[model samples]
Target: MGIIRKTFYTTVLTGASVFGYLGSTTTLISPLPQDDPFWRSRSFARYNVHHNACTQDICVKRIPLDKIRPELLQKEGDLVLEFCRGVWGGLGYKPQRAYLARKYQGPATASQLWTSEQLSKSTYERGTQITDHFEVVEKTPTDIVVRCGDTPRNPNPRDSDGLFVISAEVDKQRNEAVLALKSCFFNSGRKVEGIQGPTPGWMEEAHRWYTRLWMATGAWRVTR
Candidate 1:
């Protein structure tokens, strides 16, 4: 009887955990199937987007401009660069150190390479590698788009075809600016091969939550 009771509770808890996990991930929308011309052409055509887990697929987030005005939106370029420099390392996931490995002056091209190091958050672990092929695929006065992809040194296979598209613009009609981040990656075996296993569904939920926090914090940091 005791064993039966334990099994019942375990089953109940497992079901609850699964339900909670699914509820959290329901809103995560990958950009792969979207009709946006630029995303379709540039990201899809160029990368190995498999639409898997957090690191292996695209997830997007947006935040309102709030007090940020249109005039400030014109500085999107500087804001993005600053976010990469000052904000990315400390994003809510885990705190780490980062530094630029490349430089760019004007609009970047397909060959424009941007590399940076994300030092391990743990005092004992070695730093993780990060790189981006940056290009201003499109830019206008009030809006700009920057595309980023991972490079060879990145440790995770999921990052091999990684892409992050940052788009910023002011919407005068809505009285809010939009800061949208679209991210995707491909492949998945390397990081999980050794002792690690497949990414748990709960971690994806955490990724979605932390991603939103990261975007919100970035928006606040830039406009603050």
Candidate 2:
């Protein structure tokens, strides 16, 4: 039984190490206060009624705008859009997009499909489709809100249909731009039951890891 105990302890240590590493690069905000600016933004206003019923996750990192390339600030929306593209370009998101494409018969080239020129010119207009599952719902110079998941075209939609937001706002108080990634899920209008139940703990943890990695990669891309 000594060998069994050793193996058990080893497994626990390894898991803890992995979790610690993942947590190191992440900054998450849960149970966002109702008064948070995000809730008052135009993007959120579109879905304000559903806020209380939604399952939301937010991850944030601040970027010192004064330190980054100055040309990126030439245009009003340039910084936020570049940051959004960076998040989508993250290595960790590639596999997730691939899996979704294969499982849902979505476009095969959904990952990194946007050219630099195309992204630079994009205004993120409402109803614009960003990928097979992601569509623009609202946007401004600082924030872009997207609706993702099964649509009315799908004979059946999953409970995961929801909103994904990427926002970069200059905070005068901190003298930095706050880059945030948020995911919110309520009921899939296409699904009669709405969100069936709470997400599994393992799934939530995995999602947190993915979000952190993606956010970190995006920050690196913008700052580097």
Candidate 3:
């Protein structure tokens, strides 16, 4: 009986120690820039630079806006606003809240901030130091193009030197729209810090996945 009690206590202590270690060292994903408020409070063990490249990932997903006409797609109202809201709100690991700045430099230029809570409870609450800039760089009756600028506060010190465009292509006869998100970026200069992620190949793949996910979410929001 004494031996059994000692073994049980030892096992319990071991389990407790393991759990405590995991709780202390586990790496949680902090909210990305442009996420919602639930993600505002989270911690990141390290910055993951999946793809710090000049290569491009073009994720094109087309949705038929049967109800809306080609002419209406160019205007800022229900369809346009909904699509913008979709881009602002959708696609995050956690629930997100997005805010767009009221002041615009030009007709379609604006800055947006996304804040979200960490999926897991975290003490850190800087809400991913990143800001997104967007612009309606090109607009026509048939096509409207939205450009997303490099997010600030990037963990990877490489810096983004590329173009990211999300364009809406309208088919007048079919009355359908094609949504395309192109992420083109190249890392410029050397790493300021000695730190970097392990796998460069995986980083590019992850980048593609993220951009694709973002495109898919936006497409689903507007079309569905």
Candidate 4:
């Protein structure tokens, strides 16, 4: 089915009427337009400098394993995130802080323990470290959240032990197809994750969608 043709939601969106079972009326509540939690929680920069010297625009990119000078790692104290792709979470984004404590067989003070009870045994084994660390953004100690990063559901090619950013992955992973889809929605004063459009996926797409909406509806537009 075409993307637009695809219903906003499944079953839940479609009301039912049989045996007096009034079409499911359980309303789905997301966040608001102006305060998208996901975007707030996970947002990074992709840098590309095009130097046009009236001659030609040359892109200065740092590539790895290509006669490169040095390999850099993103480190902050006990936290160490390896950068495979030349790009790492730049300055714009901050680490998530909505940490979830793992039910450990070891010490409880162990902050970043991967909860095998929450995740899987293999996932726990592969874990060199675990974290419940996250960032709290907004009023009322409650804000945009990033949960359970000290472990993974499964340490396969996709799942890694580190901060999980939906935006960066969506764009960097491949062509910005999914990201474009998200750009279709994003309303002003819509209260971040409002009970409206925009589903979960990668971050770039999420921001693209948000930025698009912010632009279209003039969310950030200066009105006289």
Instruction: State, as a TM-score between 0 and 1, how close model 1 is to the true structure.
Output: 0.48
lDDT of 1 by residue, 97-124 (tens): 2233333222432232222223112111
lDDT score, candidate 1: 0.43
Give the TM-scores of the predictions, in the order they appear. 0.48, 0.72, 0.44, 0.20
Ordered from best to worst lDDT, the candidate numbers read 2, 1, 3, 4
* TM-score of candidate 4 on Cα atoms, chains taken together: 0.20
**Candidate 4 per-residue lDDT over residues 1-224, each given as its tens digit:** 66656664444355323212211211112222345343343321110011111100111111222221222112221011111110112211212211233233245435443333322221122232343332211111111112222233332211111122211111224322111111112222113333433333465344433333222221101111
Total clashing pairs for each candidate: 0, 0, 19, 31
Least well predicted 10-residue stretch by lDDT in candidate 2: 188-197
State each model's C-alpha RMSD to the native: 11.5, 5.2, 15.4, 21.4
lDDT for each candidate structure: 0.43, 0.66, 0.42, 0.23
> Which portions of model 1 show Cα errors greater than 4 Å?
1-33, 49-66, 69-71, 82-86, 89-151, 154-160, 188-200
lDDT tens per residue, model 2, 1-224: 99999999999999788668657756787656677776676655554343335566899887787865666667787777777777765665667656654555445434323443444355566666543667777788988888765542442334556668888777778777788888776554432444333456677667777788778767765674
TM-score (C-alpha) between model 2 and the true structure: 0.72
Model with the higher lDDT, candidate 2 or 3: 2
Better of 3 and 4 by TM-score: 3
Which clashing pairs does model 1 show? none
